[model samples]
Target: MKAYPITTRYIKRGEDFIPIIIDAIRNSGIKLEDGDFIVLSEKMVSTAEGNFVDESKFEPGILAYFCYYWSKYLWGYALGKLLNIKEEKIKNLRKLPKKETLRHKETVIRTVGLRYALKPYAEGGLDLTNVPGTYVSPLPKDPKKWAERLYNEVKKEFGVDVVVMVADTDATYRIFKWYITALPYAINGIISGIGVLGFLLGRLAEIFKVGGFAGCTPLAIAGNKVYKNYSIDQFVRIAFICDRVHNTIKNINEVLEKYNSYVITEEILEKLKHTPVVVVKIKEEYIPNR
Candidate 1:
């Protein structure tokens, strides 16, 4: 499989991202072909979809405080080892400042609920990285809509057979043929709403290397893969390819450290590259004459 990353400027909120992305792909000098796949970063779609929240406006309740402590203690201590999460990451979680982060935890509790609020970072896929101060980009309300629009728009521009996927950096684990993820939502194929346990169990297995792959999962899919009835495993492999090619998995913590503050400013963003779109060409041999 061959993958190409289409680079674009930081896609801010209120921008017409779909047209801009298609234009980037057009200018990228790569030709879209039949059976190709287009993978989009969920952050880009969610931001353009206007999902940013002013977290400063939300107050943390008792439940939010509990989640904050839970994240600092449980995930920072025991759960991290069980999942074999990085020791440095666990240390950071342990040292999370209540004064700086409690409000965000409360926001998660109120915005999504206790289920996602229980997890440590990327809580329900809500993140502050690459976003402006006191603002977070929540999960897109309708990922399928984004994927469908991209599918149609790309075809309109390039006139080729292609599948469109809006995807996240989060991984989905396969167990006894059941594909499950910690994500609050997923596309039609992978399972969702499993919450913290999904993350724990999946990462536990991942620690020991359990699945054929564990990288990224599609939030929603459209076009050729839907018509072909591609298995969840097949689709996930495609997402993994796109994710690794771009390899933009810098967590919010890293972003915080780089800027020395919880708030990621526009000056910090200038130092980073945003390639929210990837065009992929898969070899039929990846699935053996499918």
Candidate 2:
């Protein structure tokens, strides 16, 4: 399958993103075709919808401390290694300063739940990267509705039918025949709602020789596509491609280390190219029981 990345001006909170998407497609020089797949970044859409949350606005309490303990002790010293997490990350987790991350942990518990609090990052898909200070992007409200709107709008603009998928970098892992995602709200039959248990199981499955982890989480699919047209396995493959192409998107930590958190403004972020939209061509059809 061939994939094309569309670049547009950085989108800010509450900005109208649909027009930007359409404009990017128009300038991309890649014609949208029937049966193509259009993948969107959840971060971009959530930001456009003003779904970002400031952790500083929240208060950390006892339960948030427990989450801190989970990160510092369980994940840092024990579970992280078992999950084959990188040593540098484990070390950072062990050194998590309560002063810095406590409020964010509180926000995670309040927004998602205690179950999601067990996760180090991407708790219930309230991911904390690719944004300016103290902000997290939660799962977009009615993601499928958003996908349908974008699909209809794209079709209206281009006069071509296409599959529209909205996905996040938070992962969906596979073990044997079972598919489970780190975050809830994954669509097209990828199981979720188990909280971090899915991540634990999918990682541990490697030791048990059952299965291993796989692609990023796809939250919504529109145009009666994905599971209806393509096999779930094929769709998962498509999602991974989108995630890889999105590497052009920078992590906020890049600037946080060089400059003060308060000084790393949106203008500096605009210096980076964010590939929030990727269009894919399915070169081959999935054959049943092939």
Candidate 3:
């Protein structure tokens, strides 16, 4: 199988994504054919649909305060150490500020419920990586619809019958064949919304082999018979690889420096190759092996 990262100019709110996808395909010089799998970064779709929140406006409630304190003091120092989490991450969690942390926790609680709000960064698929300022992108409300729309548009534009997968960059834990993720839903056999307790349990039990970030909540897979049995490992590998390609700015610090407004302007984004779309060409002969 081969993966092609399609580079395009920055996608702004209210901009039609279909045309941008067509342009990216044209620029990549890759011919679309039947059964080709198209993977899209969920952030791009969310941004286009204006599915973002101004985190600064959130007001912390009692539950949010408790959750913040528990996560920072208890989870960060005790549970985190028990789970063997990275020392740096543990330290960062312990050092999280009071007011800001409470606001962030509150946002998570309101967005994905109290259970999902307990997880680490990118809680409930709310991400702050690419977007500027205090603007955080949430998982698309209806990913399956977007996937179907993209598939239809691609067929209309290029006469190609391809599969579309919308994915995020949040981590998912797996035990043997069982895929456990923080998101509430998944397309394959992935168990979702297991929360922080599940994450810790999975780690302590040593059942998790690949603990890296998986795709987002509501991963939408449309069209193509080849993806019927696509495993969790395959999805995680592809999603993580594609996510790295979508990170136009090498790191968060660079993103902040380049776009002080926090919102990446079309002008600045145009100069960089923002690859939000990836085309994964699966080899039919190796389907059984995969």
Candidate 4:
């Protein structure tokens, strides 16, 4: 299994990710073959898909306020404490409303239990540095769409049997878990629930060290044995190895935790300023055959 880092200027809106990736791999002197899996940064895909929200246009509805005051205090504080966040921030976060709170507990439990949790890895949530006023960039609504487009592009350009996985580099802070949330060639609607389940399961695999395979529960069940020979399978393995990567959550307390140095390259930051797709590719064998 091999992982290659392909860095370049930001990918603008409508930029075809397939060409960028192929060119990058070629430039790196790595030849790709059929069955290879590409692990892309999700922000890049979101950006290309116009999945970002300008903070200047942010509208914190009643829900946002509720999150800010209620959930922040209760669930945010509790979770922060559970995750070992600092005392002061917990206090501050506790003042926030539940709906206004960006982090939700029941949502976490339902979505992926404790497996798919996130702390702000970057400083853009309520930033004055990058944007003029306070603003937060919410998660993308359709990660799978971004993935499918890239997958089709790859197939058409290289004519290889490949899979495209969009991920977040921030996901790797506590663990190297890249967000895998789309499938390109399945029954469209039937694939939806499966995609969500697989994505959450992938997070579970990372937090709990369950498996390195990249798909869902079925993958966990079926690919259990053969996950080591392929890159996607290796994803399941890493996720499995990092088992139970749970963070804390509570709705009864107020807490605020700050991690200031979450690093995004200035290059990538500028790109994200306008769009979110960050592309990178890895070989089928990056994870060894178990």
RMSD of each: 3.6, 4.1, 4.3, 10.2
Give the alpha carbon lDDT tens digit for every residue of 1-290 in model 4. 44445555556544556577666655656555665555554444544554433332434444344334443554455655554445766665555333323433223322322222232112111111222112222233465665566667766766765555443322221124333432211111112223233434444555566443443211111111222454543454333322222111111231222213222234434543232222223433445559
Candidate lDDT scores, in order, read 0.80, 0.79, 0.73, 0.38
What is the model-wide C-alpha lDDT for candidate 1?
0.80
User: Considering summed lDDT, which 10 consecutive residues are worst modelled in model 4?
Assistant: 216-225
lDDT of 4 at 39: 52
- TM-score of each candidate structure, all chains considered together: 0.90, 0.90, 0.82, 0.47
lDDT of 2 by residue, 158-219 (tens): 99899999988877777888788878678857888888888788788877888766777888
lDDT of 1 by residue, 1-290 (tens): 77788898887786768888888988888888878888888888888877888889987788888988999999899888777787988998999889657888888877887898898877888877768888888788888888888888878888886888888877778865678888888877677887887887777666666652355788887887543667788878778888786745366667666666777876667567888888887753434345
Order candidates by lDDT, high to low: 1, 2, 3, 4
Which candidate, 3 or 4, would have the higher lDDT against the true structure?
3
Q: Give candidate 3 misplaced runs (Cα > 4 Å).
A: 205-218, 249-273, 284-290
